[model samples]
Structure formats: structure tokens, C-alpha cells
Target chain A: MAALCGHGAPIALLSPAYNEAVTIVQSVRSLLSLQYPAFEVIVINDGSKDATLDTLIEAFELKPVSRAYDLAVPCNEIRGVYASPRLPRLVVIDKVNGGKADALNAGINISRAPVLCSMDADSLLEPDSLLRAVRPFVEDPERVIAVGGTVRLANGCRVRDGRVVEIGLGRHPLALFQTVEYLRAFLMARLAWSRMGALTIISGAFGLFRREAVVRAGGYTRGTVGEDMELVVKLHRQMRREKRDYRIAYVPEPVCWTEAPESWRVLGRQRSRWHRGSLETFFRHWAMFLNPRYGRVGLIGFLNIFIVDVLGPVIEVLGYILIPVLWLLGILSVEYLLAFLALSFTFGITISVCSLALEEIQLRRYPKARDLALLTLAAIFENFGYRQINNLWRIRGLWQYLRGSESWGVMTRKGFRAG
Target chain B: MTGGLLGGLWTASLLMAASSVLFMTGLVIARLISEAGRARRRARREALVADMMSAMDGEADAARLKSEVREPRLVARALLELSTLIRGRELAAVTAALTQAGAEPALLRLMRSRNGEDQIAACEALGLFPSDKAAAALKTRLKRRTSMRVRIAAARALLQMGETPDLNDLLAAFDIGEVHAPLELSAILDEIARRATEAYLERLKSSRDAPALRAMMVGVLGRLGRYEALPVLLGAASDPEPSVRAAALSALGALGHPDAEPIIAAALDDPVPEVRAEACDAAGRTALAALAPRLAERLDDDEWLVRFRAASALLRLGEAGRETLDAAAGRASPRAMRTAQMVLAEAAA
Candidate 1:
């Protein structure tokens, strides 16, 4: 099915970069190696403080090109457009620091393909990723408005020429925990949501969207931290309002590898930012909160967001506090308290392990029993401390949301370990 | 008091926790056992692929190949794996040897499976054995009311077998309707048109009532570089549906026929922004030098894409277009000046 799907539809891959000099070249190289018939890679350097533009120009022999772009979507002023004389498929845009959303908008403006794929500069797609990701669009072109693929951690993988040549579990405990968390998130949660036709979030790490649909939906809301989720929700809202038949799909076969944060501080900041972004999107689209007008997307999709994202954090934090307090105040017995905590932890482990088992059975990307065993261990151990820390970060994000904070905390990157 | 009210909750929590732990442990053990078995099977398959490759290269005899072919499914898997790495005579040798070993019956049986994955795999495997029987089975799959994926796979298999179904049959097999005009579907149409251009063109002519289908067919003709499609495309340039008109203009642009200059010139003033934009693009693609002035006039068009494409079209008109762009860049409307300057800078670079 995948081999028959990718015929000759030109697609544009948009990679929005901000201070990504370390990984941009590798990412572009991997994208250029994709096995699609026709595609162009447009790298938008969002006014990085580092020498990202310089590095790209040096690597690809880029020169300023006189290309006209439309203002179909609003973005910051583009500094210049660059293209490599040797590489016809590579286009570079230099624009002001308008955030990732703005950079993506800038990319959408310059790209001329019928379909547009938005990805991060820090992630590398498999060689056949585009061919696999594009199946839904080919299968049902009229209804499938957007599609997302699974993203896996590349922290401990052996990298050669921007490809994950060997898969291994991350050495850091935090990274290991995230590996299981991502497995659960993408394999269990997203797959189920996609089956229900209520997939509202196509990860910013890698997602494909119909160019016209995205352009009509106002191209990634600029000020939102969760621009990916916001764009999808906006699509659902507009399509539902206009009473259009559409689908947002998720395919698990196509895999994208991204570096996971290894440090506690970085992971915390990332989680909090993600939580804050979800909150901002949910609040902005509060009208669709269980509103039947939006169909399943409103009732099921948004309801999931409200339960898991909005209230789950508060309830979790309350459980952490009240379980102990109630026990200390004699309102709850010791046996009852231990049982309750054990149930929560065990349930968390069960979910994580289930996702791991699903991945092992289906993907087998790990290809090693030791890696699976380590992941299983991480899943069980995470319930002891990592999950609690994550909830605390979510609580922090909630606090920041209440205080009306809009800052996107700086996320540092450690470049992939080269072969 | 504590025993009565909290008793049920405690018991339920403990039971749930224990059950979850046991369930998780059971799943892990099951996966580990499954992985170990899979590993052994993978090793055996690797050895079989080695044997098949050796046999194909004539290092080994057909007796060894026949022994391995006892498991037709495994041999088919090996052939599929080696298909990507080997080609030309090596591929033909493998296919002939596998066909002689009777891998066809197993694959044909697999093709009749209810599972979509098995059907897809069977279709691909049958592509290697492009006999009349294989083609017949593939065509039968195409005619079935199965999933689109299976149908596409079957169609691709037919193409691999060097069989071009009638254009109507192919369209119906694809389940192409008025609303379903995916780009890849157009590509399949383009591929079919490539094999029998005139027949496909005549089929397209009868699709006038299906506007989307007509537009897609017209676009395929343009991509195929069918110079004979000029008159038909010219008629389509005035299609009632804006989408068809846009498609015709784009196809005309792709064809770059000199006779399309007049229509392309008039389309610059099209009421629809998309048509006008395609007109500007067509003007540039054909290098309609005579339409340089008309394309220049569109620099002040209301639509940004139209203005951009017009400026690009002027740039393609050699010296005349460059002078117009230079003039516009120096003194024109703010929108036009910005577009002109950007276009010229790109040209200079």
C-alpha cells in the first residue's frame, strides 16, 4: 500500500529552526534522502542567535535568490531568501524571530506544493517516512485533512549520516522514562483518538497537513506555544462550523526520530511548556468543550483534553497532598492509603508497559531484548518518582497559566551522537 | 467504622493493584517469549535468503532452491527482500527460479485472503511473477469491492505485469468519483494515459459532466506533455467550474503551446483569483513574450499570488520582462514594488 501510494504529488517539507546550527545540516541531509518522487525542503532560519544561516549557506552553497512569496499567512518580515545552485530542492528563508509558529507561516507562504509537511529541525525522518505518511492523503484525498506519524526518542541510538542506524534505550533515567511515556502517548492515546476520528493534536515534531486547508485555517496561530495543537483544533472548528467532511489521521508505521531531553531541568521545562500550551489552547477553544455542534471532535476529543490535560493535573496534585493528609488526620486508614497509592502507581505502570508491549509486538524497532527489559523497568520505576515530578511540573504550568505567563522557556539541545 | 466504610475501597484497590501488576508482568513475559521465537525465525530466514541469492547467481543448484521452496511463503519473503537490492538479470533469474518452484499457487491463495495486509503482500509478490494467471488474479482483485489500498496494490501489480487495463476500468477500479481527485490518483491516470494517449484522451472527453474528473484528466494530459490535447484544453479553458478553468490554464501552462497565448492573455483578467494566478503562471511557462505587457499590468493585481506569478512571468520574458520589473521595482504600488524587487533580486542572484 505504501509503495503504491506515493506516485508524483509534490510536497514541501517545512523545517522551522531557531538556533539549531547543531542539527540543521543533518536534518536537511536526511530530508533530502527521502524516497519520494518530488519534494522541496524549505528551511526557515528564524533569526537564530547562533550561526545557523551561515552554517546552512556554507554546507549547501546557498546564495540569495529572488523568489516571490505570498502573504497568505502573516509572518515576520523575511530577511532574505536563499537557494543552493547545486541543490534544486533546497530553499532557505531568513526571517525575524517570530517564534516557531511564525516561521512555519513564513514557510507556508513560500512553499507551492499541494501538501505541506511541518517538522522540527532537530528531528530526522526515516527514508520512507514521507511515502508512508502520505498514504492517508492518497487513500482519501478529499477527507483526510491532516496526518501525523509516530515520533520515537533517538537519544541512545547510533546515528550515521542523520539516520538512526541502531536503536538503544537512553542511558539517562529521565530519557528512559520519556521513552515509555512517548510510547504510551503515541501508540495508545493517539492511535485510539485517531481511530475515533477525534485526533486534535498532530505533534509539532512531525505532521503532514493539506496545504489549502492549513492556509484557510490561518496557518498556525502565532502567539500559541502549542501551535501544532492549535492549528489542528482550529481546523476542526472551522471545518465543523462550515459542515465539511474531513478527517485528521494518524499512521503508526512512519517513524520520526527526535532527541529527548536528558536532564531533569530541561525535561521539566519541556513538560510544563507542553502543559501550558495545552491549557492555552483548551481555554481559547472552550466553546467546543463537549459542545455537540463540533461532533465527536467536540465531545470526545476536547473532552479528553479537558479530563487528561486540564483537570488531571489538579486532581493528581490533590491526590498527592490529600491522600497523606487524610491518613495523618485519621480520616483514612494506613491500609487504605497504601492500597490507593499502590493502585495509582501500578495502574500507571500497567499503562506504560501496555504501550511498550504494543510497540514491541508491532514495531520491534528496539530489536533487542535488553532494550525492552530496560524500558519495562523504566516504566515500572517511573511511577516511584518521575511521574510525581511530572505532575509537579504540570502544577507549575497551571500556576503560570493562572498568572498569565506567555514565556516559552529556553530549551537547550545536545546534538545527536555521531557514528 | 473504618472497617465497614473503607473495607470495600481497600479491598478493591489492593485487588486492582495486584491485578495490574500481574497483568503487566504477564504481558512482558509473553512479549519476551514472542521476541525470542521471532529472533530464531529471522535467523532461519536470513540463511534462506543467502541460499536464494546464491541460487540466483548460479553458485548453487535448483535442488537447494527447491528444498528451500518447500516453504513457498518463506521463498516469497526472501524474493521480496532481495527485490530491492538486486535487479536486471539477477532479478529475472530469481523470479524465474521461484516461478519454476511453484510459488505461484501459494501467493494466489494468499491474494484471496480476507486480511488486507496479506492481500497487499500477495499482490506485490505476484508482481514478480508476471504470468497471465497472475495478471488475471490481480485484475479480479481490482474488480472486487475491497479496500482502496488493496485495489491500488492490485492496479500497481497489473502495471508491473505490463498490463494496462482500459481507462474506464482503471478509473472504476480506483473508485475515482467526482469528489475524489487525489494527486496520486491523477498520477495513476497519468501513467495509464502514457500507455495509450489517444484512448485516454477520448475517455477524458466523455467525462465532461464530471467537472473534477475532467479537470484531473486535463491536468494529466498537460503533465504527459500531450501537444495534441491543445484544442480540447483550449475548450476547457472556458469551463463553467472555476476549478476546471484553473486546471485547464495550468495544463495549458504546462504544455506551453503558442496557440494558447491569446487565451492566456485574456485569463489574466479572470474574475477568480486562482484562474488569474494560473494565467500568470501559464504566461510565464510559455514565455508569452507578447503578453509581457499584460503580465506587467497584473503586477498591481488584487491577489498576492497573481501579482507574484505575474512578476515571475515578466522575469521569464527575457530583457523586456526584466525592464518592466526594474521599472516596477523603482516606482510602482507598494505591493508591486515589493514583489518586483524580490523577483529581481532572485533573478540577479
Candidate 2:
């Protein structure tokens, strides 16, 4: 039974490529190289005008077929969910230009499997990522509704034979900031919440959900900036109301790595979209806030999501806005203002550093002394400017959400390769 | 103005802004370094533990397993898991590793745990692994050992062919509470309890365990259809604990002791509603129609829970409970009370 680690499951990967010509091949190759006994890769050319579809066809010998099945989520119109007979498992959904949500919905409806995982098209998975990702479901039935594997900063990490070989430091400052932020968020924030069984988001980049639960929750909502958060919240609402025992989960293993935005413009757009989606989810289920009928999920769970999480960035922005005024108005003396900022900065740095310590305590990542020193510096420096910039972007996101604006922007990738 | 009081003030203000700028630069630098190092070690740690399980037999091997391993808890777990895998004495190293890891206060607490699986493994690991290696480290827990799991394990180990001296250390670990506790170390505690079972029963004859023990007597005697222990059962009808009194009432009914009817009648007004409620259930169950009127009178009890229970009890008492229940549900009880309304509806239904 133990030897059959990668056996049993017939798997498929759906890479919804929108202007992912640079990453399409690498993503497909990673999926094809999975250690599973049998599996296929499906690259959905989500109406990218670029060489995304052509590159796949030329490289993997793709041929089009009629849309196979229809378990798609409701975001955009599906022109056709296509398939290639040569590599039948390597089907391509040639759909009309719908956003990511529609592309995923198309993939879901077309695919036939009890288990389906959704990942960002640019991201690359480890050889047995799917096998490890699906372990919990096989081991414990009914208790687990979704399983999320770990994602690391792909910025400086060396990709060798489609696997991360040596962990390298990146030269780009923006990419570096994202690495620390992702580490702190995943290692500290998500770990704690998942431990408490209040995991709200199963990251858009790398997360797996039980096919039936996703469909049962009416799939993903259309025209939402935060489709990930919205779909996860809807699942929580449906499960709690039906009084079902289920869990949205996270694993600590780094199963996938995607390109982080090296440019501030792309990073700002990502943060803005995340904030807008979070607000939409909370406001959509505002009724569950403090309602005891929902049990532990209602009061404790939703309250944490709403106040501590969704509204946190905005509150932080306000704190930033208030500090300057307080100093100018003499409500706060110069020394007092500096001290308060110092204390808050120190506190933020401490949490990151402690998270690094705890992660190391459980599973040490940076083996080299220089790597440890670099991570320590990153932990200390993360709280200052990057946090402020994030707050500003989140504020912008909140403003855009209130103004009813939606931006389905595309992110450029610097393809995964050997260091 | 040259580096004096006013100059100090100006320099301090300048430094504040500089600190903010420096802070921003620090954050950028940190991000740079963090991105440089992202590590992944797939499932290799579990395999390491599986290896340690059997290599733990020797003190040197145990020390090496303990010292060399990163996460002793996981290693110990892997050791146990490996022990399950192969049909051999391979887990010596694993238990040795666990005992070394278990020297920590938290793990020691786990070793002497009241919990089922966790404690058993910890106990077995501590005992099976060379005890001499962890003896000095465990010496501190001598007094606490008397608390539960240790005493049981100690008594069991003492019964084995031959073991080293340290009776005082073992005795200090034996002082424990008398209650039937559901502890993480319950089995170990119970095993220890077995060592003093004769003395415990002697103590029980004049102790608080007398009530729970007496209730057991009621169960035994009632099943035999004998009226013996009636005095004890009647005395327990007034016991402080409602659960004890309820047990007595149940026993009296099973025995068909007519002498308990008066005490059962008075107990219907017992302040602790459950006792009164259970007494009513036993009375009604035993064909005590004579007590039906008194039970029916409780239909309008102040505590709505009691009133609901009485209505439920009366419902089982047949048509004889109608007149009393009907009056309780009459216009005297306002529609504002939903409990009464529910009771009336349930009785009608």
C-alpha cells in the first residue's frame, strides 16, 4: 500500500493559459513528468492571442476536438472545451476570452475526475506534487473537502530538470519583497488559521478542492475580483448550513513555485485584486457575522476573517494616515510618535523572525549560513516600507471595489529555468 | 548654537526622518536576501525515524539516535511505525530515541500520560528502551511519578524477575487522588490502582466511593428482584447529589419496595429538578398509580424544564394524569410561556 504512493489515481492538469507562451511549455512539461502511474496534461488556451496555443500545438502535437464535458464554473462563455487525440490526456480548451474563473469553470466541467486541482498557469509543480496533494483525501474520507499544497518564491530558486535544485537569492528587490511576504503569510498566517480549521482561502496559485464540494457550492461566482475567496466562502456557508463536517486545508510542503511580479505595476494590480475579492466575500456573507446558528464558524471564524483579515489592511492604512496627523496636530509628541512607530515596526519584525524560527524548528529550509543570515535580514526589514506599500494598494483595492471597478489584467512571466 | 541644546533638538528631528527612510531600505534588503533562499526537502525525515527504531538497543546507540535526530517526537513516531512494519526487534533504537526525546518535561508528561495511545507508547518506549540511560534524567519526576502512570508501570516492572533498587523513588511516585479520574494516564493509573486494590476496597467501605459503590449494589440487588439494601437505598434518596438520589429511586422501584413510596413522594419536591424528575420516572415506571396525583401537581412547577419533564412523566402515567395536566395548561398559565404551550401541545399530541 505504501509503495503505491503515485499509483491508483488517474490524473490530469488544466493549465488555463492566457498570454502564457513563455510558461506554457514548462507548466505542461512539469505536469507530464508527474510520478503518478497514469496522468495527462490539459492546457486550456484561454483565448490568448499570443503564441500560447501555437506553442503548445507545436511542442506537444496538439489537435482540436469538440468540447468534451460541461462541469465549468460560471464566469465567461466557453466557445469550446477542446481535446487532442494524439495526447488525449493533453486536451486544450479553446474557449472564448473569459477571465480566469470562466477558464477554470470550463476546465472543471470538461474534466472527469473525483479530484481536480486548480493552479495558476505560470506555476510549476514538483514530480509527486499531485500525489502528496491527494494523500489526505485517501487517508481520511469525508473530513477533508479541500487540500492546499505549499507554494514558494520561484524568483531566485533554481529550476533543474523541472524541479527546484538549489535555492538561489534573487537580484530583483520587488521579487525579494514578495518572497518574504509569501513566507510570512503562508508560514505564519495561513498555518495558524489552518491549524484552527478556519482556513478561508486556498490560494489561487496552488490549491486542490474536492470536485463534488466545488460543484455543490454552485461553483465559483461570476464577475468577482476575488473568485478564490468568494468560492471558498460560499463553500463554508453551504457546508455550515447543511451541518456537514468538512475542512479547507493547507500542507507545509513546497509543491509548486510560480513567477512573482518583478515589477511594481503588476504587484500593485495583484494586491488590489486580492483586497477587492476579500471585501466582496465578507460583504456577501455579512449575515454570518456573529450568528450563533452557524456554530464555531459564525462568531469566531467569520469575525476573524472580517475584522482581523479583510479589514486589516484598510485599518493599517488608516493607522498610517492617522500617525502623520497626530504628530502635526501635537496630539502625539515627536518622541512618542517615533517610539510608537518603532514599537509597531519591531513587533512586525518579531513575528516574521519568530515565524522563521518556528518553521526552522519544525522544518529548516535555509541550510547554508549565508541563507540563514539573508532570511534573518529579510525578516527584520519586511515590516517597514513593503507593509506600507501593501496597505496603500489594499486601500486602492477597497476604493476600486466600492466604486464597482473590475480589472482582469494579465501578468507577464519570466519562465522557470535552471539557475 | 554650535552643537548645544538647540542643535541637539534639530539633529533629533533630522534623525527621526532618516530612521524612517533607513527602515524602508532595511525592508527592501531583507526581501532580497529571503528570495535568495527557499528550500524544499521532500518526505525524507520519516525514513530517518524508521531507521532509528531498531538501532536504539545499546546505550551508545540510544544516545546517538537521541543526539543525531532533529525531531525526536516524529522520530519516535517513525520508530513505532517501523516497529509495526517489520517482524523483529528493530524498534530498540526508536524507543531509545523517544526516551531520550521524552526527557523533556512535555514529553515526560506524555510518557506518563493519561491519554490512550499517546501515553501507552510513551510508557512502553520509556520501559522498553534501556531505562538506565534515562534514569538520571527521569529522577526529577520521582514525586510526580507517584501521581499516576509511573506507579502502575513501576508496580508492573517490579513484578518482573529482577530490577534495580530505588524503592523510595518509586514510593514518592505513588501518592495519587482517590477519584475515578479519566486522565491521560488512566490505564497506568488504573494499573497502579490494581496494586492497592485490596486496601482500596477496605477504604471504600467507609469512603465517598460508598455512594457510587452502593448504587452498584442497587443494580445488583434490584436485578435479583430482592428488597435487600432498601435502608441504604432509602438513605441515598436524600443524598446531596441528584444523580445518587435518582439511582436510589430507580433501584427502589426495581426492587418494588413499598417502604420507599413515602420518601419518593417527598423527593418529587426535591430542589434539584433532575432528582424529582427521575423519581417521577421511576415511580410511574413501577405502576405506582397512588403517587400519580402528587406527580401531576408538579405540572405547573416554576422551572419550565421541570414542568416539561413532569408533563412528559404524566404523559406516561396514562389518562389519570389528564385532569392535573389539563388544569396546568388552562388559562391560569398565560400564552406568553412557550414551554407551557409546548407541554400542552405535546400532552395533546
Candidate 3:
């Protein structure tokens, strides 16, 4: 078990907060309760207009501390460093609003830990998340530079004292649909990719990385909305090019419960931004697409992402519109149209159901049968309307990306339901 | 003709859709049944665990305990739980109970199962039994070209069994060709260093081992900080491979032997920047004041990391090193100045 401690690599959990005053306190509290033996929680207040820094300062009893930190990575100016006298492991950095990547860079510079765990301010990690997620690093200390945990929707879960007290299905249709989607993405796709040693993205919600490797990969690249994916790709390229044995792993057990956008508007914005980020990363690392030099990552992982993820929406959206148009124009026979529709919908439902089955076999987090039934229903119902809307949003994202739109869009959060 | 073609396509797609629907329905039913079964098994296991706990309190006989947990899965689970909860004589007692229950044979059979996941579970279960047979089974699995997951599980099982696996087999299994060996080797060596330092030392001295593996071994030795490894590390400092040489230099630093200062200082002039960079770090660790001047010369080196290391090493040398950095900051190259400033700022913080 001592070896499981990653050679006793100290971890720094960095939460870059931006106007998340409502959720920041709970997230920080959740991070503070992590079961890891050696870790420090550093919250970077990215010049939020809201009282995020004030909330953290008041909650943690933080006092300004003069500390010397290496500027290991380039970042925007950090205004001040604060530490809690009561909790020595808790540190907060007040810095200008330099987006997520810049804030992460600042956190990297301020952190002294050998390992860094980047987290979203609105996400609540399970108590043993760090302990479980760090196993890959411990097991493969030389080659495993990064490990990502599964991110589950917290919309339906009951929260108390910054912890998920009760797990349940949200009555919101959008929330339930997103839960199934998250489960499918994390449990099936990410797991299969990681098993093949071609995991491309460790969700920004919760990911652990070696500080040295991240630093050597030039930290998180600034200005990209997909900084997390960009960083993973950069690490893969750098490590592979240097002929170093490395693994970017995804652990399915350690769950990071994150607040999902309940409203269609917010969800649309989030999906569009995510799609744009994927496209940006895809184009940025175009050299790796089908390039055998990068091995499985370039040959399979990159192509899978490019086709199934990046271009999937465009194809689906076009299918939806073009089929109707073609049928109306007499080019597509009504019988053929009906059959095609049936095939697509049923196949989609089957994949979703299969993902649910995989979830049951592996994690089985949702205890109540009623919740599982609701999720199954949601998986089926999502194909009717929710998925189509999501496809359209992603298509819109593609349009925006082509139009050179770099806007992250305003993400309004209602915070988690506390009990 | 077109009508017939369309009809055929329609019929085909309809069949595909219907089959998918049927497949999903079957999966749903299967999942429900499996979940129900698992729940039933879990309830039984819980009852058995409670009985075993009471038995541990002297309420039940060994024969009764074995009968109470007749199922192989239950026995393995109980043993795993008890192993972690109790230690010393209590653990020995639990192991004895498990053996009497024939847990070893059951687990050995499971370890040889065709299913990879089953093999992993069995390997983990075997870890609860501290027997030579269990260790041998795990070692055999490690040598097999099993999935990476199963191999790692077997290796961990062996570690739990307190067996030091052959380092060469471990390296070969990981395929240390062009890339560095998997980091799991580090964990294995960490465990080995604790249990069998002699065996680890012998492997380190074996020239047939991969350079990356030998270098990693040197790192493990350095982390162990065994003064006895100083001679081996000193010999490794001049290895043909620069990576091994760098590893040796870094290990020497970790060992913190001031007597190795000459060897480390010579590495500062090595053709490889990586080796020289490690030498600078080693100099800092050993507080080689004589090398401080030479380290200062690296402050202007072409390699940025080497320059950074040189500056940091100078900082570690205290007042004399501080003088060298101050001089570099004022009169040396731009990179030297930048490095010195950053280190000084860090030092102040």
C-alpha cells in the first residue's frame, strides 16, 4: 500500500473558481475532506465579479500570507496568496481573470506538490476519490502522467456539508438525459479508450496529473476553451515524441459529482462550447490524425474523436433535415425513410441501454431500481427530442467554430441542492 | 424495379431495428436478473461476515466457521476483509481458518479461469493467503502474456504475498523496448527494496537488464538512501548510456555522500545536457562548495534546464552559492540572470 502512495508524491488539488461563490465554499469543503494522506487544496479565485474570494476567505478563515512560489509556468499576475491558519493545507490565490488555463497555470506555479489534481469549483469529489484515482499513478509511477475520474451529474443528488448525501434521479428531463449521456461517455467510451492506452481527454471537472510532466508540457495552454483536452493531447505528443513510456488513464470508480445545467439554454451553451473545444483541439493536433508515429492514440483515438465526436453532430443534424427534404422532393421513398428512421432511433436507444448495462455491471451507483428505470426511460426518450436538440446545438457550435467564435458563453449555475 | 429495391431495403432496415429492440430488451432483463442475484449473494455474504466476526470472538468453532462460509466467493471476501482488519497473530488465525476452508485451492482454480476479470479477482483473493503455492501461481500469471490489467494485478498479488518477482520478467512483460518501462516497476522495486534488498541489488548489478530498468533501480536505491548502495551507484555513474549515468548521478545526490563529489563534478562536463543537469542537482544535494564555481559556469549553458538546475544548486550551497548567483545576476548572461532572479525570488518566498 505504501507503493500505492505513488512513491509518496504529494498532491495539490487546484480549483480555479470564477464567480462561483455559491458553489465554491462547498467544493472547497469537499476537497478538504479528501481521504488522501498528503494533499493540499489551493483555490484560485480568477477575479470573479462575485464574492468568490470573499466566500472562501470567510469560510476557511483565510489570512493573507507572504509566500515564495516558483514561476514554473507562465501565467497572469497573481494579486495575493492567502492561507488558513487553522488548516495549513488550504491555500487561496487571488488572480486576474485569465480564463481557466491561466488560472491553472497560476495554481501550478504556486503549488509545491509533486502531483497536481485539477478540479472545477462547482464539482464535489467523493471522499475517497483521490485515493482511488491516484492508484494508477502509484501502480505506474514512471509512465502514467495523468489520471481522470468519472464525472457524474449532481443535479439529482442531495448535498449536505459539501458532500453527496443521497443519490437520486432528477425530475428534470434534461438532467436525466445528461446523466445517461455522462454515464455512457465515462463508463463505455472513456473506459474502452483508456484500456487501449489512447485516452485523449481527462475531463476538466476532475483530473490528476504529475506536476513535472504538466510543467514540461508547458502547463495548460492559455486562451483555448478546451485547455484540458489540449493539455492531454500535448502531453501525449510530447511524451510519444520523446519516446517515453506514458499512460493517460481514466479511472471509472472515483466519481466527481458536478452540477449539470438543468435548463435547455444553459445545456445548449455548454454543449456548443464543448463541441467547439473538441474541434479546436482536433485541428490543433491535426498532425496526429492517422499518424502512425503516435501509435494507438493517433491511429484509433484521434480518428474516433474526429469522426464520432467532432463530426458526429454535423452528420446527425444533416440527416435529420436532409431526409425530410429528400422525401418531400420524391428522391427518398416513404418506406425507405420510415425504415431508416426506425433503424437510427432503435440503434441509438440500444447503445444507450447498453451503456446503462455497463454502468450497472461496473459501478451500480444508482441504488434504487426506480432510478435505474427512470434512467433507462430517459435513455430511450432522449433519442426522440433531447438528442436532436443537442445535435443542433453542436452543429451551431461547428458553425461558430468555423466563424472563428471563441466565446465560452455565459454559464449560469443554480448551484447544488443542499439538504 | 426501383420499388422492389426500396422494399428490400425497407424490409432489411425493419429487421435490423426489430433485432436491436429485441437485443436491448434482453439486455435489460439480464441486467435485472444479475442485479437481483448479486443482491442475494451480498446479503448472504454479509451474514457470513457477521458470523465470522463472532467466531473471531470465540463464539464458534473452526469447523463451524468453515461450514458457515462454504461458498468460495464468501471465503475469499471474508479473508480479504479480515486480513485488512486484523494483523499479527489474529491474521495468522484467519489465514489458518481460510486454509482449513480450502480457500487456497478454490482461489488457485479461479486464478486459472479463462475469463481475464475472473483471473484478476482470483489473483487478488490469493493475496489474502500467504502461501508459497499462491505466490507461485501469481508469478506464473505474471510471466504469461496476459492482459496488462491481469499482469499488474498478479504483480500486486505477489507483492502482497511478500514475494520479490524477477525484475527481468517484469521489465520484459512491460516491453521496455524504445520507451521507458511502466511506472509500476517503480512500485514493484519500492516493495522489493523493503522486503529483499539483496535480490534487488543483484538485479541492479546484472548488465543484461535494460538501461531504463537499471536506471529506475538506481532511483529506487537512491530513494531508499542505503549507504551500502553508494559503491554500486558510483560504478553506475560512468555507465555507457547517458540515461543510466544521469540516474546514477541523481541517485548519488539522493544518497547525499560528499565523497562522491568528484564523480558528480566530472559529470558536469558530460556531453549530454541531461547528465550535466543531474550532476548540478547532485552537487546541490552534496553541498560541493568546490563545484559551485563550475556550476556557475553552467548558468550560461545552452540548455535552459541545465541553467535552472545550476542556479538552484548554487542556491542550495548557501552564502558562497548566493555570492556566485549574485555575481551571475549582475554580470552573467541573460538566461543566467533570469534563472538567478527566479531562484532568489523562490528562496525569499
Clashes of each: 2, 25, 4
TM values, all candidates: 0.87, 0.56, 0.84
Order of quality (TM-score): 1, 3, 2
DockQ of each: 0.28, 0.02, 0.19
Worst 10 residues of 3 chain A by lDDT: A1-10
Candidate 2 CAPRI-style tier: incorrect
Model 3 C-alpha lDDT per residue in residues A230-319, reported as the tens digit of each score:
999999999999998788989899999988888889999999898888888999999999999999999998999889768798788788
lDDT of 1 by residue, A1-419 (tens): 11112354578999999998877887899889889988999999999999999999999999888786778899999999999779999999999998999999999999977789999998889889998898777655446789999999998888899898888878888889889989999999999999998998999989998887888898989988889999999999989998988889999988999999988888889888899999999999999999999999899999999999999989988987988788788887677667667667766776887787788767878876678778878988998888889999999988888888888898887878787
- In TM-score terms, which candidate is top? 1
Model 2 stretches astray by more than 4 angstroms: A1-11, A66-68, A71-77, A81-88, B1-349
Write one digit per residue (lDDT tens) for candidate 2, span B1-349. 4336445554554564455345545544554554463221124454454345445544335554454444434444554566567533445444444556443343445655455455544444344444453444344433443445544443443332123424334433554333122122222323333444433233323325433333332333333444545676677777764545665676666676667788878888888665676577666666566776776666556543345556656656666755455665564444213333555563443
| Selected candidate, larger TM-score, 2 vs 3 | 3
- The stretch of ten residues in a row with the least summed lDDT in candidate 1 chain B is B177-186
Compute the interface RMSD for candidate 3.
5.7
Q: How do the residues B1-349 of candidate 1 rate in per-residue lDDT, one tens digit apiece?
A: 8677466666665675576567656766776787898888788788778776876776655676666666655666667779889888888887777666667877898788787777888887898888999999999998999888788888877887789888788776666665555555666677888998888878766654455566667777777887988888887788776667787898898899899988988888989777898899899889888888788789989867678889988988888888888999999988889989878876676
lDDT of model 3, residue A58? 90
True contacts kept of each: 0.29, 0.00, 0.15
